[model samples]
Target: MSRLPTRTDTPPAKPDPADKRAAWADAAKGVCIILVVLWHVVVKDYLQIDWHIGVPVPGLWGALGEQFLPLRMPLFFTISGVFAANAVLRPWRVVARSRVAGFLYLYALWLLIHTAILALAPDLPTDRATSLLGLLEQLTITPSNLWYLYALALYFTIAKTVRRVPRALVLVPAAALSAVAAAGLLDTPGNRAGLYQNLVFFLAGLHLRPQIERWAATANRRRLVLTAGAYVLALAAMAVAGAQRWFGVWPLVSVVAVAFGVTAAARLGRWPALGDRLATLGRITLPIYVIHMPVLALLHRLLHAPVSGLDGVGQGLIVLGYPILLTGLVIGVSLALHRGLLAVHARWLFALPTSRRPAPRHVAAAR
Candidate 1:
């Protein structure tokens, strides 16, 4: 099986570590994390009004969320795959220490934090298991929003095991699994279904990293236009099929939508100022992802009714604007909290408690 160049390669010119941190990739991640927070806010804050009032209220926000669902998590997992491409080539111990252990640590830590919060707050609406056995089941099976972290650990393990296999062989079965999951044929409980559904895109990202990198490097106006058109069409098809309740092929459409979505995000990341800001956001996505939910939940509890009395355009503006505003607030607050935690020697909040050697002279000098 052919492989992309790894850090082990003896190239004539060393690639800049900074260049390895692709601005576009970071921008794509930034867009993904923002969308995630926005989706959660809209669902919990705005759309819950219908449930709260005991009527199915029609709104553009819910429709918009449904339409973009395919792109959101799929894009996130694919981007993760792109980063994992190189990591998968490293030794098993290194891969375990860095990717597997890192993700598991965060997942376990946050699982406890979220469980404790829900347990302590009796008024908060939580469907999570509260009984000892139930809590054990949840810890073992369902991971909630932290499912992505768990999925990454699983994918990394699988990737290492199958690293010697032909890329096409690996991806074909993975895609089939995604299709099966999307089609509702797999019927696994809880996050297992999501794990299956997203595995293909992650594998595609890992297997096709070289091709994707080459395409991005050489992408031009025509390719961008074509990709954008394809993405729009895919979303339209998905919408129509979804309305008809045709579930079997939604994952196939999702694959196309995610491919184009990543492409579009990459192109948009070329803008200097916007890309820089997004790249910075991307760098802190982990903390943002972990912290944003609690912030949104608190904000939702405190201000869920602030815009309820508004009408027409005022309602629409609040519905649309509040999420963006709250997303900004969540990001800002999360960053501040992260910095404060770091300042107080609370790095364990974000990372495992470990120590390492100082940076190499050349790498530090490059910075």
Candidate 2:
């Protein structure tokens, strides 16, 4: 196995201080986080409940959500992979202490918190193991929303191990494997299958960091036009494939969508007001991601039932508008919970006690 960087090994150059690369990355992450939250709220909670309660489900939001599903989580892992590029070049101790430990802490913490909540409220939709052995088994083999955290730890470890390999050697095989996995060639369970499906994008982000950064920096109009055109073509192809039941084509379509989505986000980051707001949201994405699910779950319990005397359009409006409202509420409450409650009262909600650090200088500017 490849070992981590040592004293003799030169560290990767720090990200350019003058470059707006991190800002664009943050903006991308911000957009992704919102989509994730909305996907869960609209698709998982609202749509399912609407179907269960015999309400006429609106096609608009559901269609839009499905269209972006592939890009959403893939963008997240890609951005994370980019950041992990920096981590893999650090000393082994730093990598272990900072990256591995931090992710594990949050994963374990939230897992237990969610597990406890499920155990206490057996009436909720979430299922829990009744016996201690069963609980341990679940904990070992299963992770709910916190699977992202688990995958992050695994990805970091793998990235470090392969740091010495030629980028093409690793990336090409990974991409092929991801395509196969996405096409249902991987026989793993859902969560594990997700890990396999996303692995290529993560590796691509890590290996292609230099090229990606260059892409972000340049103002290449031709490249933008080409990317947009390709994305449109891919979208059409995906729609045709879906209608024809050609599931195998989806993996490639997903890759194209991700590329276009990331580039678009970078372009959008050039807008002053939007970029600034997105960067701020991106900075706090961790807290929002960690806490929003529980908030949404609670909101679901309260809001799942359909109201009487509303027409299909009115119900559709409520179905659409309510989730956005819940999303905003989750974001706002999560921010307050992190800053007010967690920051002072219980910092361990999102971090290990010892892992806490002072805010970065650019944090203020991002806000």
Candidate 3:
């Protein structure tokens, strides 16, 4: 079995200073985070509730979001891997204190928080543990919407353990595991499948850091266009052939989508206003990721009845606007709530309470 790095090993290198030009990574994260929020908005809120509006438009929105399934979380994990490459190289004591402990702490803290809040709105359409045993399951074997945190902590440990191994040794198995999970051969409960399927992308982000950085830095419109075209064509072909879940199809699709996502991020980040704003959102994605679900649950409870009772014009408006509008509202509320918690010195809600200064924004937001 592999062991953690000993203290006598070289210390972790300090991260690069935040470069305005590298806003592409954050932009990529912004695109991914928005899609994630949109997915939850469509699935958990729009699709779940009995809409006075017809299902056709809502269903269309859901399908469109589904088309990006290969992109969102995979891209997020890839960028996270890129950001975490440095941190995972540190001695066990440092990696444990900064990365592992912080993630598990937030996972445990927010697991309770999610449980308590969701308990109040049990009718809202979302997963929640109804019993102590179920809650224990979530803390251990199962994964909730908060699975990203759980996976991050685990991935860091796995990457560090295999750091001394050959690259193929780590990546090949991770890719095969992803292919297996994406094929649904594995019975992953709740969001546990994501924990299995996305390991390869994260590892790629770590192992292929130099190439990825170069790709981002040198990305141009032609490459973006080519990648986007290739991804869309591949995705469409798979969907048309209905082979999306065939043993290895989904992983290939995701790799193409990730390339497209990175290229698009690089292109988009060239625009000053958009790039800066996305970079800003990327910096705070952690808060949005953890807080959005509960906020959406509450919002669903509050708005479902009112929205369901809307008349024809209101219903029509909802069909056209519900997913995007609801996603934006949820993200806004989540960010505000995070700011409020910080103001109250409830910093532990987001991170482990330690005397060490918080990790730099890029390093910390990888989760």
Candidate 4:
């Protein structure tokens, strides 16, 4: 059995000066970004199964998606909620400083970048800058995958505001909100059923983080080996079924089930290297996230004819690897960028003791 990953420093109660950049949540976010990238890689060029020579494997693409659909954007929001839970009562400046500086800026900035791509690309559906729909359209649907950022920002802002409410109260309303959307009476940003799935996950993360983290700490190191295998097997089963749309009544059941299964597997004990690197990658998952669509699309378009040997199954593996690799590369680059950029904007991306220190008693009390 493999040993669980140990946090050498574990970001101290106040995370030391030298340890400022280390973040556990960041690594998980990295995993989430990889999943997002993989989702796009498979779904985009779905028609090119024969692009790979002879393998007639059906649903290889969706099988990959099915294993990971549970992972996708929900975990990211959930993790964000976990960290933000501690700071919900901070002054407005703090929220704007950290979450705004990190998440909001990324959202607004990426929105423009993607909109530009959709505008100039011949392959992409026209945004028709001159038309009324174009103006409203940008607000309605995202270029492809960028909407999650904006929606996340909105959710965090709202969650932080009334976070003082009882956990039960908060959960009930969010659940009701979700039920309304599920019933099709309400809508989310992307016009998908059960939108703000990410927000609900985020809320869950905020409330459940402590318990979840502890569970990770408590799992037997040896069990991780079996649990990891079991997780993969369970996912494979779910993936195969998902490809056939087998559950009959609920297609997304695979996603919900498998995601929980993976979350459970993380406790089996992460390899120190994998976990640490993933944590590092998670911190910059946002930029890696934005980088994925263009990166995967370009790579798939470039490799389509040449890599035809794998058929769909082979191509499926390539699709899976691209996001995982690209996420690491983009985050590696972004982490450097964050170092330089954050020095100028430290208050935005991280919390510092000086800024986070407690207030002193009133001086008039000296009398």
Q: Which stretches of candidate 3 lie over 4 Å from their true place?
A: 1-21, 52-55, 355-367
* Candidate achieving higher lDDT, 1 or 3: 3
TM-score of 2: 0.82
**lDDT (Cα) of model 3:** 0.82
- Between prediction 1 and prediction 3, the one with superior TM-score is 3
lDDT of 1 by residue, 130-234 (tens): 777766765667656667777887888999999999988998888878777777777677677778888888888889888767666666678778877876787
Which candidate gets the maximum TM-score versus the true structure?
3
Mark the 10 consecutive residues where model 4 has the least summed lDDT: 1-10
**For candidate 3, what is the TM-score?**
0.90
Sorted by TM-score (best first), the order is 3, 1, 2, 4
Per-residue lDDT of model 3, residues 1-367, tens digit only: 0011111122223223356334888778888889999998888878776665544787788889989999999999999888888888889998887777777877888989999998977877677999999999999889888898888888988988899999999999999999999888999889888999999999999999888988888888899889999998998899899997798899999999999999889888878678767866776678888889899889988988788787867788667787888899999999788778777867667767767687899998997
Query: Model 3 has how many clashing residue pairs?
Result: 0
In order of appearance, the predictions have TM-scores of 0.84, 0.82, 0.90, 0.66
